[model samples]
Target: MIRFDQVSVCYDGTDRPVLRDVDLTVEEGELCLVVGRTGAGKSTLLGTINGLVPHFTGGTLAGRVTVDGRDTALHPPRELADVVGVVGQDPLAGFVTDTVEEELAYAMEQLAIPPDVMRKRVEETLDLLGLADLRHRALSELSGGQQQRVAIGSVLTAHPRVLVLDEPTSALDPTAAEEVLAAVTRLVHDLGVTVVLAEHRLERVVQYADRVVHLTGDGTVTDALPADAFRTASVAPPVVDLGRLAGWDPLPLSVRDARRAAVPLRKRLEGRPAPPARAGGAAAGPLLSARGVVVRYGDVVAVREVSLDLRAGEVTALMGRNGSGKSSLLWALHGAGPRQAGTVRFTDDGAAPGAAPAERAPAPLRGRPGRLLRGHRAEADVGRRRIGLVPQTPTDLLYLETVGAELAQARRESDGRPGLDPRGLLDRFAPGIPDGVHPRDLSEGQKLSLVLAIQLTSAPSVVLLDEPTRGLDYQAKQQLIRIIDDLAAEGRSVVISTHDVEFVAAGADRVVVMAEGDVVADGPTAGVIVASPSFAPQTAKILAPLPYLTVAQVADALAAAGSAR
Candidate 1:
């Protein structure tokens, strides 16, 4: 069992305690979920579990922390390493060795476990987590989810009694996140090890937790069962919401459980009123056009023969694997790179970067007299301001005091009307209650929302979002989709570059799949996703036995199938 008695941790020179009086306990074999909004001390709480909070972090610590009959206050992490295995939020931070096998065996080597035992454990862990095939693969070559699994596997190889994870799935897509979570569940259920995790993707993890440790932004920890914890919390998963509406006893945690609880709901569906038809928005002409665009970086063609038309009021999803040139394509579209070939034109429907009065280039033809060639134009300065680009990382755009301030700064830089309410955009997309807090302290999802809000502040006719849902959870992905839909409905064209195939199918009106710097497929969302040889996750779920993307479409398809039967 792991126990914390009145534990308080304070970073150096900071008057505020990151974690205060965090009294909690997790018995052997118990699966405890630690949940809160961003900067709510969730990471701090997990650090305390593995002795990183006060030990490695150089923090002022108070009170007692006991793990499996050992006092954590007196014992250093090295002394307790054999008993507690910790996987941090960024798995890369914990990686020590180069190869997957070496990484898995490093902890065992530290403990001086016999070579035979180490080898046996490594093989078992690799097979258990589906890393057997990837044993020889370099850490750098694996996807984000695969790397995280390797990190977890390395620690589990030590056979620690307690396992603690911090936002393990935050960096993964839906399918990857599901695989990691399922592996975690198997570890606890089959191996009888105590598991403690801090995660924002409550909709996915909450159903599996035996108990919940709810922490407020103020750094207070309270223990409650899953239902009670969610009841008093600000956020909840979709199943939790469904439970509240249907008044299910003991509230179903997983979708399977929810499905069982929904037997009565299935009956009610027979007479349920049809939803109103979704009226299509007005179609606008292409605002940005790329014709035969080609970009090469030192012999590697990042984009070749890529032609795309960005409509004024639509969201286009650009899908590709890692190193598949999605980012490169976005850069070319934003004029961040020099196109060796082709033409990118900005129409008069939006502010042409070259046409903007603020960006007028002083021009004189090289061969002509200065006075005679003064009216000549330069293409470089003209194209710069026409496109407003939002990069993948939120921190790249955020260096402000509060969420409001960040949006205000964006408005100031924009060509639109000054004094635009940042909160209005945030409320529409995020709708959370962290109104007065610093934008940097928000959750990964919230931070993305704020970044997009700042991007929208420009009121550009064309908005480019790169992996907006990259590090988000299921609910967070839904939020991003809603934001994309809203942006398109407002007649602002959006281009989303992402690996999340599900998001592509659900939110984008059109899908463009790229590989080897070339467009492999481009069509309407359903048409492209369904016909493609490469699998798309969200669409795969619907197409498991039905072909649909949105939940409403799923319902309609089911009804149609039922009537046919």
Candidate 2:
């Protein structure tokens, strides 16, 4: 459907080409997933397909890009719109209309389709995307997931043969992300629409991808068959990780396939009893406490009577289905949202002369008493630099020229004392990216790591990360888990809001499950994961219930069992 020949794209502002010597092709009805560490030119490659790179962004193009035989340079975005539909990472930013129905119809109208045809297409799109109930709703009234669906529906309504979605589900929660991805998969599998997407959540979508396109920091592209691509690429899915361990030649993409591959190992186990819980150690006092918090947006109650305590030196997993109030709770605690009635206290259990709680005084005071121990807690005032946040949409934080400069800004502005080496810390945490390039140019995984480098630069005691591993491949996920583990070992309190149950089970010390603006379950990680009626434990854990939530944990358990036997 699209081909790039010796393509080198250099934007007007910068001297270096964002994508250099990139030669690639996408056949009709092919589903290709483009992945790289952040700033690695994945987005640029996609932009080139629809004439957004050199054309709309005012860049110099040295090579030819052909979409359905039409040269991208000769055809602008409008001209390509009939053949291609592009949905970017931020759905709200792309919205040009107020209502969902209007948004879906706007593209058709632009194409000059007749009124009857436009109406039929809009109706079909609404039904296909499950937007019938939301047809009359304003764009602003929709949640991030709904808005993303609308963005997709608007594009799909154009009935373009090729669909190029850039991080389509990055803003959505887990269930919503699955819905959007499933919809996309159907479009390719059933409808024969060529699909090319850049995403961070590899595990969820890798199963559906027919091919994987790997890009490096240097803007090099390589085509790999699904299995080969995942194995050699920067990251792969959890099933791939499991396949590697089990010595499967072609990695299984789905849990069902993984289970079949594991049958031999299961038979070898001969029904060994599952392992016991690891919550025997007494948990410490509250590192950060919240009591009777109530936060509402207009007439909608986001969080009601929610209370919890995060202990020192432990990682807490905040989990829920999409729009289940996980983000709202974090915002309320961070003071980003209004709290009708609540108090958050942060203090060291061993600290000397701890002061009484400052009632409704200021956010800084609440974080001050604990500042001496842990640099930041969510309750801290914005200016105090006590809490470091990695927002759901990481792009919101990226406006710097280089990754190094971005980290430097965080180090300079953070509450940490003088003499902190931002570069050294970034190297330690994010290590691989080139030093001089802009952060916006990196891949999804690299961008995530770069932001983490910035968020953790201050060495804050409490770090709040929303979906840190959502888009990462298996390798990147492992790397991020190790980083989080090290942070937890440093006595820093980390709260990760995510939908990856495996992440929560494997990495977190405790798990907090929220639904409908209330915490439904909270306890030791293993306990909460197993207890949740909505959460189905990973197959490895179900077959061999380990205290840990990762594949490494399962490996350890098996090794220990072999030793014991």
Q: Each model's TM-score?
A: 0.70, 0.84
Model 1 quality (TM-score): 0.70
The digit string of per-residue lDDT tens for model 2 on 1-565 reads: 7888998877655656678898888889899999876556777888889988777667688889999999988988888889999987668778998999999999888899999999998888887767898798788866666787899899988888999998787656556667778878888988889999987667667878888898876767888778888777765656677678668766787777777677776665555544432222345666667888877777777787899887767888888766577777776665544677787666764322333233332233211222222244433433234445676667666766887677766665564664235566555545656678677666555667777776666566567888787446545565667777766766667899987765666677788888778888887776677665345445544344323345664566678787987
lDDT by residue (1-565, candidate 1, tens digit) is 9889999888654567877887787888889998765556777788777777688777788988889888877888898898899987656768988999999999999999999999999998897777887798788655455677888889989998899988776555455566677878887899888999988657658888999987776768888889888766755665665566557787777666766676765555444443321223655888777889887776667788899888877788887554467777776777654577876667645454534221233211111232212133333223323455666556656766777676766665553544235667776555653545676555556677787776666455667877776445555566667766666777778898875665565577778888878999887776776675443433233223334444444355456657867
Q: Pick the candidate with the highest TM-score.
A: 2
Candidate 1 backbone clash number:
1
Return the top candidate by lDDT. Answer: 2
Q: What is the C-alpha lDDT of each candidate?
A: 0.69, 0.71
* lDDT at position 347, candidate 1: 62
Screening candidate 1 with a backbone cut-off below 3 angstroms (N, C-alpha, C), the clashing residue pairs are: 354-382
Task: State in Å the error of residue 420, model 1.
Answer: 5.6
Give, for candidate 1, the lowest lDDT window spanning 10 residues.
363-372
